[model samples]
Target: MFDSRHIQTFAEVVRTGSYAATARDLGYTQPAISQQMKALERAAGTPLFVRAGRGLRLTDAGQVLARHATGILSTIATAHGQLKAITRLESGRVRVCAFPAANATLLPATVARVAAAHPGTRVELLEEEPPDSLRALREGRCDLALAFSTGHGGEATDADGDSDSDSEGGLIELPLLDDPLMVLLPAGHALAGSSRVELGELERERWIAGCRHCRGHFVAACAEAGFAPDIAFATDENLAVQELVAAGAGIALVPGMTLPLLRHTGLVARPLAPAVGRRVSAFVLEGHETAPVTALLLRTLSEAAADMERAASGSPRPEA
Candidate 1:
């Protein structure tokens, strides 16, 4: 029945040898400190201190409480250290899910960074699209999900709203970055020569759309055209989309992250006019134990993103 606050106050007063000093050090008023001490003593059903000159010294009962409290403090400190090691990466498994675009830029770099820093740690990567990534995190399928969107970036939410969907309740969403959406078109395409193109310009062009469930490609890029894309094709294969563009079959709206990974030399990359960007974020369940690893991954990806941004500005990305 010993409260942590009471024990902490008792220890502080004992260490400082005066309630006034304890109050000063802890930012508590003297009266409040005294009240807590009295409550602690009452809870223990014993006297815990005795007046010694202008200070109070431990009574026999107080000594017992101090001894127990010291152990409690030590236990708490050890637990904290354990969690720190997990963050600093002493050892553990980190499971993450990412959309294709994020995996292209963010995830690989993150994995490499985590691997080098925490060699004892293991990472499992699951590739899922935007909203589905959120679902995976809520269902406990993974520790973290790299969720994404057209503009607001990705956020992890507890999907536990109704005992029905993939998203579970008690979830935590963490924002990562807002990635600029770029144009992927065949080389020498009129739109590619320009630095950027607005979504509206392509309203009449044949569009390569993502599958129905993975609406990111269509919604983020083509939706701004103010008309649904004339879906000449629907496929998750970004490579295929680029190939089709190169073949003059159609053009596609591709994430800027994919520019560095595209190997099709016949294709050209351009930024979206008016500078549209998608938001990317990581999702985790509430009270997750792998917070350290997830944090490391998120941090590394951010660093990589900054580096990419530096290269992307005023410079065309070399074809992969």
Candidate 2:
């Protein structure tokens, strides 16, 4: 039979690199630590440790088992914390990333909910835009990523007019909502006088948008209006693009989800004349299903987006 004590001792020995060091730290004799390792190796039905460089090292199988065991330990630790939090109303931490503009709406509401539930769930929030957020997840820099996608950002496959949502590799993208791209007009630009602005009508107008990652969707949306946008400026910073528009520099496409955050009185947000918008989506690397909390966060985010849309459409949440 396997014991939690056996797992704990095996982890300690792997961490310390020597039976004697592990014994010293755990206050157990070297023989006891060795026996525990042997017991674990036998139960797992594979050799775990190998002698190397005057100390013990993990075999390939051992390293794989170690990683799984580490996660198992982490889950136990997290459950304990959550239980204590439920009792004392104190929680731990959840690391999340999002664009600066999204913080205005989603973050505030999400913070309110998590804060009320655990009262102690510390949220380590980071500011990152799409593709960057995707990269961060791939590099293990963050646990969950709040991002968006389009034809050109990352490896996206759109056949003719159909979406190959399941065709992508490297990242698993969960589309949350379709936030149409709204055209931001300069305070007193010619088209600003119109109740609605059409891209084809502004054949001579200039455009500002996010760099490569964001430019593709904005460019495609403008194309739907029957003209390529004149590239007067391009930037990844949302505020910078808005400020430039406010300065009468150029018109740009801003996602609907970020409308509330773009309170730049200097600019007016009008739906695209051709009707285009960004597809707001969440992203995570493949094979992360083992993380229960990560799944919970994804669920919470998806629910929030759905709630936002339901409120916008004046619909009620589905019956439980």
Q: Which stretches of candidate 1 lie over 4 Å from their true place?
A: 1-91, 151-168, 213-223, 314-320
Model 2: ten consecutive residues of lowest lDDT:
155-164
Candidate 2: tens digits of C-alpha lDDT, residues 1-320: 66778888888888889999999999999998889988888998999999998799899889988898887776566455434323321234456777765666676776766667656556667878665765555555555567655544342222111332334534566777777767788777766767667667766788887767567776666666678788989887778988999988888877777776776888887765656655666665455533555565667777788877776557998987
Local accuracy of candidate 1 as per-residue lDDT tens digits, 21-76: 99999999999999999999899898999899999988898888788898897666
What's model 1's lDDT at 293?
65
TM-score for each candidate, following the candidate numbering: 0.61, 0.60
Clash statistics: count for each candidate: 13, 3
Top model number, TM-score: 1
